[model samples]
Each structure stands twice: as structure tokens, then as C-alpha cells.
Target: MRLLIVEDEADLASALRTGLSHAGYAVDTAATGAEALAKFGVHAYDLVVLDLNLPDGDGLLLCRRIRSVSGVRILMLTARASLADRVRGLDHGADDYLVKPFALAELLARLRALLRRDGDTGEPVLRAGGLELDPASGEVSRGGVPITLTRKEFGVLRYLMSRPGRLIPAEELLEHVWDEFANPFTETVRVTVGTLRRKVSSPGGTPPIETVIGRGYRLVDR
Candidate 1:
């Protein structure tokens, strides 16, 4: 998963970024609220680790602004442990809050919980670049236009859209969606992804599923 860390303390930010990256997450760092806001505008991140004590403005404000625009999961970090402060953060749209000087394991556990439960209302759409999918109705669309999809096509597109830009292997895909009993063959992945690409990609356009030479396919957000 891709995550953004917004904290003013240089040491803490670097340490958290390193640890999270080691734990198999793509990490981005922002030392201030402005930087966090700017990064939010550009990239689609799975989660945001926000520290309340930012250089420019309060982290709560940045969280509110982000909640206004996107469905990104947010976990607030603060030194303040008062009930009032926690309540305020939650009321302001934080999915979860962690007190400072926290154990890395605890923080990671809370972050996982937040990511699992956080959901956005309004149009149920997962979008990347021009591609879009509606999980509820099993509908696919590109650039605000609707498209038809088979059951497997919808499932593949839904999984890809869930983690935009993340390289998901065919083995993982098969184990999760197809069947755990199914053999981990690369060909199944290639053919499924190929059909998905033809449907989702523009006419004569490069497929969004990037082929890593040794690794698996990644859904390019661009």
C-alpha cells in the first residue's frame, strides 16, 4: 500500500517512513501541512499518517481538508492524549488517532484497522486516470462513460482499482479471487490481465497493466 507521512519532526518522520517501507509499503514524506496537502492533490495514497503539530497549520485542519476532497484513510498522531482532543479529531473526520511515543507495532496495527474500515459515500466509484469501476452494481466506466464487463472482468478491474499503481502478482490474484486451490501459474494472470487491458485501455493505447520483467503486473494510475 502507498502511504503519506505528514509530520514536522524530521527524525520521527524518517524513522516511520523507513520502518513502514521495510514492512512492504510505498512511503512518501511531508514535513508540513502544505506539503501534505500538495501531495494529496497529486497522488492517490491508500493511507495518510498525520501529525497534529505541523510547521504551518494544525494536522486536524489538513485532515478535514483532505476528507473534503478524497476518500483516503487518515490516522492522526498527536502528543495530546485528552479525551476532548481525541473526540475532536474523530468529529473532524479522522478514522483513527494514535498518541505520540507509540510503539511501531501498535501504530501499524491501528493503521491496518483504519484502512480496512474507512469508506466513502456518494458515487461508488474506484477511479484511476480515466478508468472507473462500481463494485456494488458491477459496472465499469472510463472518462465518465459507461462500459460493459463480464463477471471476471469486473472482479479483475475492481481488484486493480482497489490498489492503483501497486504491482499485484498473478499468484496473489489467483489465490485471492480465483481459488486458493488453483495452481500459481503466470499464464492465467497474463491472459486475464490481457483481456482486462483490452477492455479498459483506450483504442491503440498502451495497457495500464505494466509488465515488470521479473515481477508481476502493476496498474499504472497515469
Candidate 2:
């Protein structure tokens, strides 16, 4: 999943980014409200890890702004532990709230819990033909045979399998599965998809993933 983390503490922001990336998420961060808005405008994020204090503005205001524009999940992090503060955070549209000095494991677990219970964004197991994927466990198998995959490969395949027969452009995949720093001009998406196809397909007649010349790709279950 793609995420945006709005935080002003350099160490904290960097640590969150590193941890989330290691957890197989495409994460981009902003240290101030202005920077966060700019990134928010350009990217589609599954969630936002927002700090209550910002250099430019109140995080609650930013939270309301983001909530007004999108239904993306927002997890507000703050030093304030008062019950009133938590109520305010939720009223301002945060889906979840976490206090500072929390453990990294707890943060990850809370984030997972938020998405797990979400009706719209829940991570459901995806299956197409003999291929089976467990998003929660990061497991992929074809015809009951396990398939090993890199993080990117898993993300790409998960996305493709989610939509089934819909055509997905390479740009869309790059935007959603890769971070903002990914070079759009490079052959990264194509190369990664090619490698993923080879891994998932048996040495046989045809790969289930189809390339329609200039159009993009569609995964066909056989």
C-alpha cells in the first residue's frame, strides 16, 4: 500500500519511512503542512500517518482538509493523551489515533487493524485460477505450489489479481506500487512485471498476463 507520513521530527519521520518501507509499503513523507499538502495533491495514498503538530499549521486542520478531499485512512499521532484530545482528533476526521512514545510494533499493528476492519480497504485474499495470494501473510502460490517473490513483485501481482480482468496501465502500477521517487521514464515497471510473469507462469503455452501492444496489461485467469 502507498502511504503519506506528515511529521516534522526528522528522526521520527525517517524511522517511520524506513519501517513502513521494510513492511512492504510505498511511503513518502513531508515534514511540514505545506509539503504534506503538495504531496497529498499529487499522490493516491491508502493511508496517512499524520502528526498533530506541524511547522506550518495545526495537524487537525490538515486532517480536516484531507478528510474533506478524500476518504483515505488517517492515523493521527500526537503527544497529547487527554481523552478530549483524542475526541477532537476523531472529530477532525482521523480514523485512528496514536500517542507519541509508542512502540513501532504497536504502530504497525494499529495500522493493520485499521485497514483490516475497514470495509472498503480490507485486505482480502485474492485468487485467479490456480494462483492464490494471501495479502495478510504475503504468500503467493500457483496450483498449491509456493512462489517466492520480492516485495515489488508481490505488490504488482497483488494489484493485478485484485482487479482481475481490468486493464491497468503501467503508469498506474508505478504510481501505486512504487514510491514518488521512482523514475517515470525508466523501464522499471515493465521489467518488474516481466520478471513477475516469468515467476508466476509455468513453462507453457502462454503467460496469463497480457500486454496489449500500446494499451497496458491485463491479467487473464486460465
Candidate 3:
């Protein structure tokens, strides 16, 4: 899943980004509300880890603004542990609330819970042909054989599976699977897709991924 961390503390933001990235999420960081909004405009994130104490504005206002535009899950983080603060944050449109100085494991657990709720719409496990991918567990299997994939490969496959049989351009995959820091001119998408194709393909069987001439890639359902 893709996530945006909106925190003013440089160390905290960096730590979250690094930790989440390692945990198989595409993550971006924004230190201010304006920056967060700008990134939100450009990317579709599955969740937002927002700090209620932003430097430029109230996190509640930002949360409202984000809620106005999308149904993306919001997990509000703050130093305030009062019931009133938590209630206020949820009333402002946060899906979940997390107090500051919490353990990373707890934060991950909260994120998984929110994502599970989101996936209650019967999309928790994405499937095409003999391939099966569980976003919540970060597990992929083809023909009952488990396959290991890099984070980017998993992101690409998940995005493709989300819109099965639809042709997705390389640019679109790059935009969604990679963050703003990726080099736009790089052929990373092609490379990643190639590797993913090899890894997910079952022995002596047709690959589920299709490449169209001059178009992008598509996930075919057998």
C-alpha cells in the first residue's frame, strides 16, 4: 500500500518513512499541510499518517480537507492523549487515532486494522488466473506456489490486479508504485515489470502479465 506521512519532526518523519518502506509500503513524507496537500493532489495514497500538530495549520483542518477530497484512511498522530482530543480527531474524519511515543509495531497493527476494514468490500485478496495476492499479508502465490517479490514488484502487481485486464501505461504505474523521488526518465518500471513477470509466472504456463506493443502492461485473468 502507499502511504503519506505528514509530520513536522524531521527525525520522526524520516524514521516512519524508512520503517514503513521496509515493511513493504510505498511511502512519502510531507512536513507541512501545504506540502501534504500538494502530494495528495498528485498521488493516491491508501492512508495518511498525519500529525495533529502541524506547523502551518491545525491537523484537524487538514484532515477535513483530505476527507473532503477522498475516502483515503487517516490515522491521526499527536502528543495529546486526552479523550477529548481523540474524539475531536475522529469527529474531524480520522479513521483511527494514535498517540505519540507509540511503538512501531502498534502503529503497524493499527494500519493493518484500518486497511482490513477498507478491504471488507471483498477486495482483500486480489486474484488473476492462478495468481493470488493478499495485500494485508503481503503474500503472493501462483499455482499454489508461494513467490517472493520486491516491494516495487508487489506494488506493480497489486496495482495491475486492482484493475484487471485494463491496459496500464508505464507512466501510470510509475506514478502510483513509485514516489515523487523516483526519476521520471528512468526505465525502472520496465525493469521491475520484467522481473515481476519472471517471478510470478508458473512453470510451463502462460504468464498472467501481458505486454502490448507501444501500450503498457495488463494483468490477464485466465
User: Which candidate tops TM-score?
Assistant: 2
Order of quality (lDDT): 3, 2, 1
lDDT (tens digit, per residue) of candidate 1 on 186-220: 47667877788887888778777677876777888
TM-scores, in order shown? Answer: 0.57, 0.91, 0.89
lDDT of candidate 3? 0.88
lDDT of the candidates, in the order given: 0.74, 0.86, 0.88
User: Which candidate's lDDT is highest?
Assistant: 3
Native-to-model Cα distance after best TM-score fit, residue 50 in candidate 2, in Å: 0.6
Flag regions of model 1 displaced more than 4 Å.
118-222
* Residue 155, model 2: Cα distance from true site in angstroms: 1.3
In order of listing, the candidates' clash counts read 0, 0, 0
Model 3: which ten-residue window has the lowest total lDDT? Answer: 115-124
Error of 3 at 16 (Å): 0.8
Q: Using alpha carbons, what is the TM-score of model 3?
A: 0.89
Better of 1 and 3 by TM-score: 3
All models, RMSD in angstroms: 12.9, 2.0, 2.2
The CA lDDT at 169 in model 1 is 76
Q: Write the per-residue lDDT of candidate 2 for residues 101-148, one digit (tens) a residue.
A: 999888887877776665423357778745898876788998889999
